[model samples]
Target: MPSTWTTTPVTAGLVHGALELEHTANGILPHRLPARARAQNTDGQLAMAESQPSGVRLVFRTRATAVELDTLPTKRIYVGAPPRPDGLYDLLVDGHPAGQAVATGGNTLTIDMSTGTVEHGTGPVATLRFTGLSGEDKTVEIWLPHNETTELVALRTDAPVEPAPASGRRTWLHHGSSISHGSDAASPTGTWPARAAALGGVDLVNLGFGGSALLDPFVARAIRDTPADLISVKIGINLVNADLMRLRAFAPAVHGFLDTVRDGHPTTPLLVVSPILCPLHEDTPGPTAYDFSHLAEGRLLFTATGDPEERAAGKLTLGVIRDELRRIVTRRAADDPNLHQLDGRDLYGEPDHAELPLPDRLHPDAATHRRIGERFAAHAFTAGGPFGDGTG
Candidate 1:
C-alpha cells in the first residue's frame, strides 16, 4: 500500500520552489504566455478569443536524498477533453516507469469535485513513495496529454534546500517565434536561447512560442511586465509567413509592440532582430511549404501561408525584411537612444547556409543553433556592446 500524504491548497502567485515542467511528445514547451487566437473581419477590426487547452506533462528534476509527497490533492487531474476511458497518468522515476494513476469518477482525484478534494479516483492520492534516495539526483517524468492543460498549484519537498545566491549577472529577456522557443533543437538545453544565456552568464526568460509568436499586444504586455536587465525581440519570419498584415500595418505594429514594452523598460537595452535567410521566402514568397514531411512519417504535407496571396505575389524575402528592420531601427534610434537593431544574417547567412542546411529550410538545425548562440554572445553580450551598458 502507498503512504498517505497531506493535501494543500494552491493559491495564485504561489512560488513553488519546485522546478515545474509540462510534458510534450517532442519536448517540453515552456508555459509562458496564455494562448489566444486573432482574426480580422471585413471591417478591419481584429477579433481575439481564448484558445483550446493542449496536453502537457509535468517533469521535475531533483537531487533529494529521500522523497515523499507531503501534499497530494484528491482532486481529479483535470484534462481538457472528455474523459478518456484508458487514460492514465504514468509516473516515471529515474527513467523507469514507477506506477500509473488511473482516471476515474469524472477523472477527479478527490471525492466530490465540488469540495476540491485532492484524493479522487480509485487509487490513493499518494501513489508514489520513495526511500534511500538521499543525495541522489533523480528525474521524475509525468506524461500527460498535450491538448489537456494543468496548472501546478504547489509542491512540498523533504530535502534540505538553499536559495540561489544573488549574482551580479544581468537578466536577458528575449521574445521571438518558434526559433526562440528552441523548436526543432536537438535538446531543450541546446536551444539557442539557453545556450546564449549560459554563454553570456545571464539569466533568461524565453518567451518564444512555436507558431504563436505573432506580434500580439498581450505578449508585448507580458514582456513589459517581466523584470529584466536586458531584452531583445526577434521578428519578421512569422510576419511574412503569416502575411497577416501589409507593409503599412507591419511597420506600425512593430512600433506599437516596442512602445508597449518600452512603457516598462524605458532605459533597458533593447535589440530588435530581423529574420535569417530563407531561400523559400526570399524575394518570391507565394505558397512556401510550412509543414515539412515529418521524417518520422514518409509523407509531404503543406500548411497555408499566413501571407496573403496578393502581398505574396511579390514576396518580400528575409533579405528585404532585414534591410527594412535595420532602417526602421536606425530611424527610431534618432529618438530612442536605447533601441538597437541586429541583422539576422549576422548570426547565420549564405556562407553558413552553404555549410549547414536547415532540415526544414525554416528553423535552424542543432549545429546552426550552436553557431547562432556563439555569435549572439559575442555581439550582444560582450562588454561595451550595444546590450552591455543597459542603454540603447
Candidate 2:
C-alpha cells in the first residue's frame, strides 16, 4: 500500500480547481517477451500495434467550505486526447510516481486513494479524496490527465451540488467536435469550451469527444437526458472530414438528434451551429495528410483531397450544410420560439484564418481557442440574449 502525507500548512481558503488524468501508449511495455529461440519475422511484418489506451479513472476532492454544493447536482469535467503519443502523458493531481508496482508491465495504472494502493493493470483507475469540504455556491473542477488519450467515465461529488441559482446566472451546454473537446488545446481549462464557460459565467458540460462527435444517437441521447438551461450543437466539419454521411442522410440525422433533445427540453433555448471555414473542405472534400517525408529536406507540405465526384456533387462543404441547418431551424422556429441558429464562421472566419491557421486544419490552436471562446460567450450569454431568460 502506498503511504500518504499532508503536505505543509493547512490553508483554510477554498480550493477551486480541477483534477485531471490522461493516458496514451507512449511509455507502455510490450505484452510479449522478445523471441531468442526463433528468427525474427522480418518479411511483411505487421506494423506496431496502435497503442490506444482507454478506461482511465480519476478521483479528487474539493475544499470549498462556504458554498452549498447540493444545489449543483453535477460537475463538469474536461478530457483531451491526441492521436499519437510523442513523449506526452496525462496530468494527475497528487499522483504517485510510475513504477512496476504502480504501472506494472502494462500501461494502465490504478490509484485507489481510498486504500492508498497504486497498481498497474490493463485497466486504469484514480480516486479523488474529498474528505474535508463544506461550502455554499462553490464550484470544484476535476481536470483529466493532460495531452493523453482518455475518456471521462463517470463523475460524482462527495455531496450533491445545488443546481444553478434560480434567480441569477445562466448555464451553457455546448457540444461540438474534438476542437471543443480540447484537441490540441494547451490544457483542460484552456479548451475553448472551458474558456467560453468561464467568460460567460455559466456552468459548462463539455460533451466534446475527439473523433467521436458524429451526431451519434447515443450522444444526442446523453444530451437529451441531461438538464440544461442553454444548449448549442456545433456540427459539419467532423462529418465532412470523416465522410460519415452523405447529404441525403446528414440532414435527417441532425434533425432527429435535435428532435430527441427537444422532447426533453421543449422550451429551453437551443442553438444549432454550423462549421467554421476550412479551406481544404470548402472547395475540395478530403482525407487530409501532411507530407512528413519532407521534414528531413527542410520543407513541409500538406496534401488533402476527397472523392472528386463527392466534391462535384456538392456533398461535403460547410457552406452546404450550414444552408441546410439554417433552413431546418428556420422552419422549426415557426413553432418553436426557443430554437435558434448560429453559423460557426461568424465566430471564426476566413479573415481570422489569416492570423490563426489551425494546426492540422481541423482543430484550432490555443490562441484560436481563446478567440473562439470569447466570441461564443459574447454572443450566447449576454443580457437579453436568447439564453439569458434563465428558464432551466
Top model by lDDT, which number? 1
Model 1 misplacement above 4 A: 1-30, 34-63, 66-158, 286-315, 389-392
User: How far out, in Å, is residue 384 in model 2?
Assistant: 3.0
Q: Write the per-residue lDDT of candidate 2 for residues 289-366, one digit (tens) a residue.
A: 554555555544445567556755656667677888899899999999999888899889999999899766667887
Q: Residues 1-392, candidate 1: write the lDDT tens digits.
A: 21432333222222111122344332232245433322222211111101111112334555544334321222324222223233345455654556554332222442232343344353222333344543565665443321222333334445533322344668788878667766555544456876787678775666665555578887787788778888999997776666556566767878899999999999899999888776667664434443534533542233445343454443455655676778889998999898988888888888998998676667787788888888998899877776665432
Candidate 1 lowest-lDDT run of ten: 44-53
lDDT of 2 at 119: 55
TM-score of candidate 2 on Cα atoms, chains taken together? 0.63
Runs in model 2 with CA error above 4 Å? 1-140, 146-170, 289-303, 307-309, 312-314, 390-392
